[model samples]
Target: MAEPELIKYRSATGRWVLLATVLGTSLAFIDATVVNIALPEIGRGLSAEAAGLQWTVNGYALSLASLILLGGSLGDRFGRKRVFMIGIGWFAVASLLCGLAPNIELLIGARVLQGIGGALLTPGALAILEASFVRDDRARAIGAWSGLGGIGGALGPFLGGWLVEAGSWRYIFLINVPVAAFVLWVAAKHVPESRNPSAARRIDVAGVLTGAVGLGGLTYGFTAWPMRGPGDPVVLISLAVGVVGLVAFVLVERSSPQPMVPLRIFRTVAFAGANLVTLLVYAANGGVFFLVVINLQVVAGFTPLASGIAMLPVTVLMLLLSSRSGALGQRIGPRIPMTAGPLVCAVALVLMSMIGPDASYLTDVLPGVVIFGLGLSLLVAPLTSTALGSLDDAYAGIASGVNNAVARAAGLLSVAILPLAAGLGAGSLTVSDQLHPVYRHALLICAGLMAAGSVIAFFLIPNRLAAHAPADTFCDPCSPPLRPADTVRSAR
Candidate 1:
């Protein structure tokens, strides 16, 4: 096969493509963090109970977590640029609706719509970047995307706090409109359209349906159970339906010629293991942040802005050191970093679990945040690189989509279940006395999740860096001599 044309790393087109994708996906990343910061404000404004706030957040995650694979599949089937632009437009409209929403019900509905659009665009952004740059430039481009993406996600709380303090939380949604418009313009003009020719033409409609129903049902059932009581018919039926839908989804995928998930990918132990680690680790990460910010505001008397700013330690560390972490992974292999990183994070969570009504930011919170940030900075790049490296390049989009779906699903379940397990419900989330004990328990649970992730990585992830590392490769072992085919492939 002939070589495809390369978009030089220094070219104007490459820069624009990177810019557009960075901005496009940044919208979703920002929303994920900012909404947590805004939750207390959202609760006050909407007169929403704990159950309502959970729905407000979970509604979006549920849709995104469930449909993201389908979204990636759609982009591969159609043109990535076209689908991405459409998603940006859809997101803009949804954000506008959210900013203008008059009631909690309407806001939740708009948030779901926003997630659908986000799912459509987020995977395509990375996919497009992967396809656009030459192999030599791909790693650097992805590094930039990953680093800047973290910055974007981190910016949410700072921005949301300012907006909320300035007298309205609606601006959080309103701000995305102009940003989305800019992304649309840059994408339509600069991004190249690409798709996999070998990709199946058949749409996985059933897969999408079953996945959504299953995830949404479980999230709803778990989140509502505490508020609705043990015998609530709606909760019981939802749980039952969720289980049935999940089973159906698996059966459907097994039989389908063009499965959205392509279960065969899990045949690689590394791929399966990485995703399991992602699920456990990200679940803990998500639940910890959710509980932390709320605790800071409700129990510790920190203002929304102060609580948001409290996380700057983690965000700043990630932005500064993530590239070095990536290089470290490439040097010594991912196993050490992946294993050690989660354990460090577990320690940080343990420290965080000690915070109480009298906790100080400098002594208690900052230490945990700094340690957590350091651990995360080490984990994310290596974790992602290893997961994607486990598969052939042909399946890059699908691999990323699957991993993303896992992360989001982990977050969705964590947010829903953690509070209930911590004994939080309805009107009790805001009461400092009731929430303090629950918060402590929740943090310990989160720490255990992270520790479990570390154990999984230690057991499952191979020490080699390359996707096709030989059977005998050990941690820190030298790269095996390449066969002729590999030589030619590497030259290309």
Candidate 2:
């Protein structure tokens, strides 16, 4: 059969549109990891206190994590393209504001605005891809998209660090301006919008508010912990309130007419398991990254560029192999790679734990990076494919959004949990002595998370690829909400 005409693009326009979406998405993805390198410069420039510095980053993360599902849900309510372009535009403006900020207070505020843009832009691209391609081509498309982000993640620190060291931290934010503007223009022209048929399933206002409040409150408390030394009553109070809010949000979502999270989605074992693995894996990634950057610069006395470059091998390998992993996983199944990736990554973390500050990069860091990179390359594509493949076009945005939000929240939770756990003075002893144990301990903790992820993926995820089903199979007469995305159709 001939391929559908709508799915095809003028080769040049198609490539360009793909490029712009990549740029739009990468801006959020890389910035989240890259900005950690600039924190010292930002802190010095703004006379930022410890808490202020934490907020500068965590504020954006929290907003992104909390509001993401709603952001995707909103795209479905309006139009994917409509919400996406608005998000990129907002992100650009926020970047400008972040660059122009007079103090840490204002900088943190602008960062939160930036997070709002990220929430909007990310899911629309994923939804558009699902609508744009057939099941066979969909994995390839998502793999390519994720590969671009993996590359950006690898390159970000080196580029961001160089700019910070040569000039000011302002340059890091400034660089995003042209990138965002270009994406906004291309997205406005090329992207098509899609949504669920039931328009009456209006955006969930109460669910959105509760989720945002819960995440925001939790992040605020965590941000305060380092400054308050974790034991302060005010910090404790914030933590208590945040936990209560999250529980309350969960209950609210279960009852809302158009639930932001739609607890029903978890009925598919694959969908549920993949999201769980996403959370744990991303958390490990976040925690390890935070510790590595600090160890490289603060402990080893590397320049900013040096710190950024340290991540190159891991990022490069992941970018190169991610698509292959998806292709292979499609041929066989995700069971081996998904479970193995985290398991291998866990072993790599264990190796990383052994590195002393004085440890040679070749002997200590490079080996760990290669192992971790290969494992992640295998995991990302398959997990992403399976997660979205389980759903229909209509629910794609929010489905992807929920997983993405969970990933971001995992990172935020790591940011909140790791530093305090690591005892941040990593400069205490000689470079090797001080950093060695810190790296070891942090990596070991990540290993534990990965081990858990491996088990969850093994048991919870079934042993087959997901496919879209037909109307006859839809909802089984009285099934609530929508059909489980992973249900198999009659093999017609």
Candidate 3:
């Protein structure tokens, strides 16, 4: 079959394609951090314990992280538009289920289903753009997509908080339904269908299953650890299973002809270093995004709306400075930005740790948030560029996929493990006295993680990326780049 002709970025079809992809991707991106703002309310409304709330967050991440690579491969094998629309429709249904869920268990289950849909669509959004746009115009289209999607991310917390305060926490999930429906309609009507003709026919079933089991087991074990001590047999078994499953996943990937994760890519020192930094940085990020809003509301005596808006400075800073930061990195090299950015974030985390009862937003929160935002604005682009640039062009898609999965998994594991490490006992997240100390401890731990990441970046990442690396790979600090242009060819 002859491939569809590429379109210009300025055309009406291009505009519609960009709009559909941006909105489609936003459904997943916004849902990620937005739910954190509504976590306290969700807990209260559903009578959920801390473990239940943690699962509510991690469940979505677990499925998304595990299946995202597979999702990309499926899109390439079948059709990008077909899989993307299916993901949109599936996500909408799951969101409806989430809104109507009668109990915490059902809500968590619905969230897991929601993540499956997210995994399906997230990669396809950028892949579609890469396939549909003319090569010369692809960068601008992706840049616009990144910037506009950042706006959705910036609005997420404020929107989620308002919805929770004005009505119910359920509205946060319910709202995706109409937006998704519109996206579906636009996609079906105007989006061109494309797939990788050379994509592998056989799916990596073993790799997918093992990876899912590994992440699921670890997330479950840690999430259950706070309520059930590590000494518990179930905890021990789950941990063991998680360890075993991850090892098995590695083995399977090593042997598979078309692995979801090409284990060989880790041979590049720069690629490996970049991902390590991603792991530590994103783990810290997960802790902050998960706990900060709850801390503001529960301990600092702010309303949901107030707490949600507190972090706006971070988003704004990233929006304004990310592209410039990417340019700076390109000129001076990524090493300095990557090294210094996390150090700045560590300092910000230390400041954030000081927020306590009666803390003023301006005096206590805003300063830390601003510093954190600046650090992220500096860090994300270079880190993403380095990750993609460290590898050959052929491995770009897999590298992006690997880095993204690492970030998501880091967040997932951090959400599960941070509370346990901080000595947060069962049912303590709501109590000011109980949560305050835990929050402080957790933020300090997160600070240490950021600091560690900086050290890794200093030692491991190179001053310059490969000569052939994409020149324009900037992305929103809130989410990693879905697929950078010139890096979108299927890794398979």
Note the clash tally of each candidate.
0, 3, 0
TM-score list, all predictions: 0.84, 0.86, 0.79
The 10 consecutive residues of candidate 3 with the worst lDDT sum are: 471-480
lDDT of each: 0.78, 0.74, 0.80
Q: What ranges in model 1 sit over 4 Å off?
A: 6-15, 32-58, 100-109, 133-143, 164-170, 229-231, 420-433, 465-492
By TM-score, who's the top model here? 2
lDDT of candidate 2 over 376-488, digit per residue (tens): 88888888877876765567777778878778778767866775566555244235556556666777889999989999989877677666631111111211221223212
lDDT of 1 by residue, 90-169 (tens): 99999999899888999999999998998988887877765556544554566567777877887767788789889798
TM-score of 1: 0.84
Q: Could you tell me the TM-score of candidate 2? A: 0.86
Alpha carbon deviation, residue 205, candidate 3 (Å):
1.3
RMSD of 3: 6.2
